[model samples]
Target: MILEKKVPELWTHLLMVAFAAVCVYVFLPSLLIIYKIIVTVILIVILSIDLVLIIRKKVNYLKLTRLALVNLSILLIIVCLIFYTTNFLVLTDANSLKSVLGGSTLMGKLLFLLICFLQPIVLPLPEAVTIPAGSAVLGSFNAAYLGYSGTISGIATMFLLARIGG
Candidate 1:
């Protein structure tokens, strides 16, 4: 006699829905802010709901860890892709951008850093290129320090905004 665990059809449907959500997310590009937010929220809600349902039905530590790792890996890869594409775009016009950044003066570098800090939040532009561009013009040490600090500040501001409700 062979013993097999039976699973409900709804389980298959849920798995398919999760796979489709992942596929759609992989294909979705950063376009409109509103659309992106809406789609992301929907995907997140669906995934969370499914994860909870699955976890409640069967709690496996190893499987949960694997799922977490997979999700982190996907997030990391998408972030890298965004940065890679933006960095290449900035690299091609390095000289012109360097010139436009107004040389290696302290004020100019600060301004560049400021713009980079704001680009990710205030402007529609991606922050990925700004740090690289800064590195090309303002030196690596300066770019890294300023870029990270500025990014931190911008992120902090966003957190405050989210907490305070506009």
Candidate 2:
């Protein structure tokens, strides 16, 4: 019984690790296109399983909600990639992106947060463009904190709207 209860929790952590690993490859991109394509296919399959579980009511409501959110995030990522691959959004230089955040740490943090928060819904820009630039400006820790917080808030807002309207 305890093992059964712990399985989902373990799977959640593993999924997060898989997501992080795929995102990290965008930074150290050596033959990354091939690798990302492979991992993305795997992620898609994992997401499909989650969707089946959610639709079948195999998980509790909380887990269902989480699955929904993660699925939405992955869809957003695919949208961003589509824009990127089709050249709808220009790939500006990282220095330019950092300069846009300005010099001071506080201002840099706020601007990074704002950009990351708005990127998904408003701009359709990917973190590949923002996170590296933000890290160069605010250092790794601050950049990661602001980026994650802003992203979570944006995603939560999206999920709330879906919940309200669904």
Candidate 3:
């Protein structure tokens, strides 16, 4: 009975490690496209599994799903607000896109990137808008760098929060 109780925990840890290794390996330039597809598939599979488990009542899946739904709803609302605000600012401001992009200067760009990085961790914002906006405004390389930085930072923040809460 004790062994059975521990098995699930062990399996979860192993799966997490495996996924992390896969992500690390996928970071190589040669694997970029494949990595994207793999990641998407993996996410879908994980979500499907969670939904199945919730339906089966095999775990506290219902509570987890509820939490996830709440978070997603909050994220959507924040994203909408940000989109509207950004559009309004751009429309009201006399500066054109070219001027804003050209005149933002390095510091402005860095500040924008920092906000994008911090949003996921500090706010309930959906990253869809911020990430694409970053790519559009900052270009591909900087967009990737900032996105990765934000992701890592957000993960770290979540880890710390969980630890503290626990």
Provide C-alpha RMSD values for all models, in order.
13.6, 16.6, 17.3
What TM-score against the true fold does each predicted structure earn? 0.40, 0.42, 0.36
User: What tens-digit string does per-residue lDDT give for candidate 2 at 37-122?
Assistant: 76666656656765565556575543654564476456546755764565433335576777777667687788789877776656
* Sort by lDDT, top down from the best: 2, 1, 3
Best by TM-score: 2
**RMSD, candidate 2, Å:** 16.6
lDDT of 1 by residue, 75-134 (tens): 645865785677546533546557767554888677876766775577554556566777
Clashes of each: 0, 0, 0
Summarize candidate 3's per-residue lDDT along 26-145 as a digit string, tens digits.
433344577556645554555566557645656555345445434544544565567566654562222333244445768646755665566666644456655566667778788778
User: Candidate 1 or 3, higher lDDT?
Assistant: 1
* Candidate 3 regions with alpha-carbon error over 4 angstroms: 1-103
On lDDT, the candidate that comes out on top is 2
Task: Report the lDDT of model 1 for residue 12.
Answer: 48
* Comparing 1 and 2 on lDDT, the stronger one: 2
lDDT of 2 at 156: 83
Global lDDT of model 3: 0.56
